[model samples]
Target chain A: MNSEIVAIDDWNVPHKKSDGVRNRKDYLERLLKTERNMKDDAEPLVSWGFHHYFHGELTRQDLDLISKDRPILIIHRSFHEFIMNSRALSLFNITEDDLNHLSKEEKKFASLEEGHFSERGLIAVMPKVMKYLAAPQRLITGLQITENYFQENGITLIANPGSMYNPSIQKVKNYVFGDEDTPFKSLFIPSALYMLEHTDISNLLKTTEDHLSWGEGKVGFLPKHIKLFTDGAMYSQNMVLRDGYLDGHQGAWLMENDIFREAFKLYWDAGYQIHVHQNGDSGLDRLLDVLDENMKRNPREDHRTTVVHFGYSAFDQIDRMKKLGVIVSANPYYVSVLSDLYSREGVGYERSQQMVRLGDVDRAKIILSLHSDMPMAPASPLVLMHAAINRINYAHEVAGPNQRISALTALKGVTLNSAYVLGIENDYGSISPGKYANLTVLSDNPLSIDPLKIDKINVEATIVEGRPFK
Target chain B: MKNFIFVIALISFNVFSLCSNDRILVAKELVTLDDLYQDANAVYIKGNKFHSIGSKEDLIKKFPNIPVDHLYKDSVIVPGFIEHHVTSTASCNNNEF
Candidate 1:
């Protein structure tokens, strides 16, 4: 297949065009201007602060831009809800006819609604997504989905630890600011960096403006942290813990404590915060010990360290975390979706009380930040806050009813508190003056609405750096 | 704009960082990525670190107080920018690719 480049002919710099945000040109335009010599199907991406749309065959939005050098086939979400576009539809052989025979319920499934797919349909999506696993388009789409889902909420700055790279970061930067100058702001904890250590740690930060690179939350300026993962997930009964479930398994461990501790110290000393993925109490137990040792080795002020999913944390240990000033970014969204699984496998009703202990979090003085454990749950800050306060799961069953918090505090998890977690509270946590006019217009006041109905909350507009997104 | 009030409540603290359209970095410089190096072929930005960038001699003459590196020339250093929040998910060129 001969590759026909859909090149962006003219590039332009970003100019401020919004109330408070900058009217930045898109990245493709800047890239066109930068590598002004390249001959290809590159589209010119112009941006206005957080909004960037493309001017070529490629579609660019925010900081992530996609273009084609040739026609390619790829598998995507494969179902509808229609997140993916025509080109993707062409590659995967998914057709409107495929939906022609489905009932209304199946129509809902295409929108990524959680439910059982026919064993055959479930089996089929894997091979298709796998078929295009190598496609940058798929990766781009994954990040895009992650952003759209999370951004609609009140989250201002946050990042992912999975499958994120320097290249992806640059793409994010492009989408957020386009070819224009940006009053960018964001924070990232790249979990893959856990796989790295020693000189590689020193080197990744050394090479490139690795510190300044953009990512999923890369739309704006952000601090860089090393996001570490040690186990699977809680609901799946995959997280590693010392005690076995009522059943026989003790669960899984991605790494030994000593090795993880050493790596944490390496990252910590390298000036990157250690944001680990530890869900089980046993994992948290081990994590704290490692963090304790690392802190002993390299004590710095406001390390802003954390264990991303500190599920089922013990009260005493939770207090210890507060004393140590470590953060716990919980995925209360799981409260709704997987309460039953955690109840059965991870903990019983009594232990459940401690699962997503938001109330205890406030008491322990631990800075709490809420998140939607995406690919597993919806990434709505409103929904996460509601679940945190309500402690309910997908079935509307309260996971740990006592663990629920008030609407005010829960809201902090997705907003102000998240800023503190990233050490950017001084910059972009709330809507105070001298801060970026990044705001999310909501359908109603959170304080006024019932907590459980929060996810039903609509984002009228996502105003980034003062510009609105429709 | 009505919904912004809700989003405003969500991120009230960081909004200050986006102060004025001009002189946004008007607030005191918050961070500096110092020590750009060789062997790394790294981006040694005298960027937000120093007051200015130019000929090493001129920089030295201007600020004899500050240390000067030959890098002021080869390195195209500029001001460090502040981005609000750019989620990687919005991009079309990621894991979905």
Candidate 2:
């Protein structure tokens, strides 16, 4: 991605702060000008990385005032919400008549007046927007950049859990990523919730199994693995908490409790490796309860049921995870970027500082891996390792010293343990006999370097199947 | 006849070894993450698999005739990194958002 695009996509960039736009009006003005300059004025402007925590909620009036002639849609940083201008609403043809068709619960989240949609509301409108977002060329270009980005960071393999179920998108992915020229291989794990949305529970497994043929040269579906979501994203501050948010705002669930349970049981009985995207302690509570219930109903040993994006797990949950044979693939970047701000405003300091709580996971001997969750954080393993090892926030203060892990352990999070989470450890992850000759050459050893400088260690080259890519 | 059989066996062994894609990757350090060879300075590659890993001198002694690539002699080598939980649509979503 280009620097200008990064400036628009990342809130932490110097452009957002140095542009001298403080209030909503100035911010909207700058955003409109920058976006218009980037794309044609008549073309719809869809941008991400808008956070209410930093700039407060933006209304239709704020956006429409600046972008009166052009269409604009600003996706929340979490990708769970959207705020659009009047023109954008017209462009998408979203009207009150359409809103009337939605169920009352869904309507509550979609407001035509405010031009804001979230969770169920966003789901309701996604089809209308996806055509533009998932355009073949657009997706191809984005994926080409992603491939280069991964290779530059010495990533030889990337496993995308909860990949979209759209065949067209998958075809585009195959075009770019499945090419033999691509250095890294991609494994797509089907999303249980996405499948359930398009097909009945009876055909869910069949639909998932159909994706097995999607692989070409370098892209393939990870068989017998499915992804499920419990709560909303932590970035939106919508993750369900045990004690609730300090501001008294309630969190939302991505999947209803009964539906999540039914889906979990279906995959569990089918002998699939289940990966749950859980954030808050309350969400973890629900996940653990379901796992325990399933275990009692039909005990399965060495299941390797993984908990993904463990954003705010409790201390006791670690022991429960061990007992349930659950491993973790956590986004340590949450503590690195959001901990300080969330501590002051969102969840209060205690829970915010302990967002990832990986140290506790490590202490319990639970297998732990780290992920960028990509647009949530840069897809750099070194960055993830730095966050895990140092636990340092944007202010350069360690949010939770107790949660810090050793450098070697942190390295495992991005290498061996990460492959274990994907159930591909035998072939990838480590430099072992009979495994693929995949090695990442680094400027320095992460285990011997300063924890704070781990991210600074440059990737010299990556060897994939005995072929080196520099 | 026994001496002739011995010569044939040695020739077959040498031919087999030469035909295989074998090489030793000499690096400043190899963080194998393999339990038996946690840290080493050399890795023997046979085709697309890691045949063995040990100190440079040891691997050299074992496979004396194998080609050695000192290209990464100044760099540290570790297992290829894996991204366990990224979405393929994330980049598209970022660009098209």
Q: Would you estimate the TM-scores of all the predictions? A: 0.57, 0.92
Error of 1 at A316 (Å): 2.3
- Compose the digit string of candidate 1's lDDT tens values, residues A286-402: 878877877677677788777676666677787778777788777775565446545654355567556767788877677787765442334456656677777765345766666
| Backbone clash count, each prediction separately | 101, 2
Q: Which residue runs does candidate 1 get wrong by more than 4 Å?
A: A1-131, A140-158, A162-187, A192-224, A394-396, B1-97
Docking class of 2: acceptable
DockQ, candidate no. 2? 0.48
Across residues B26-49, which tens digit of lDDT does each residue of candidate 2 receive? 999899998899768999998878
- Per-residue lDDT of A448 in model 1: 52
The ten-residue window of minimal lDDT in model 1 chain A covers: A1-10
Residue-wise lDDT of candidate 2 within A67-98, one digit each (tens)?
Answer: 79888888776878888899998888877775
The candidate that achieves the highest lDDT relative to the unseen native structure: 2
Cα-based lDDT at residue A357, candidate 1: 73
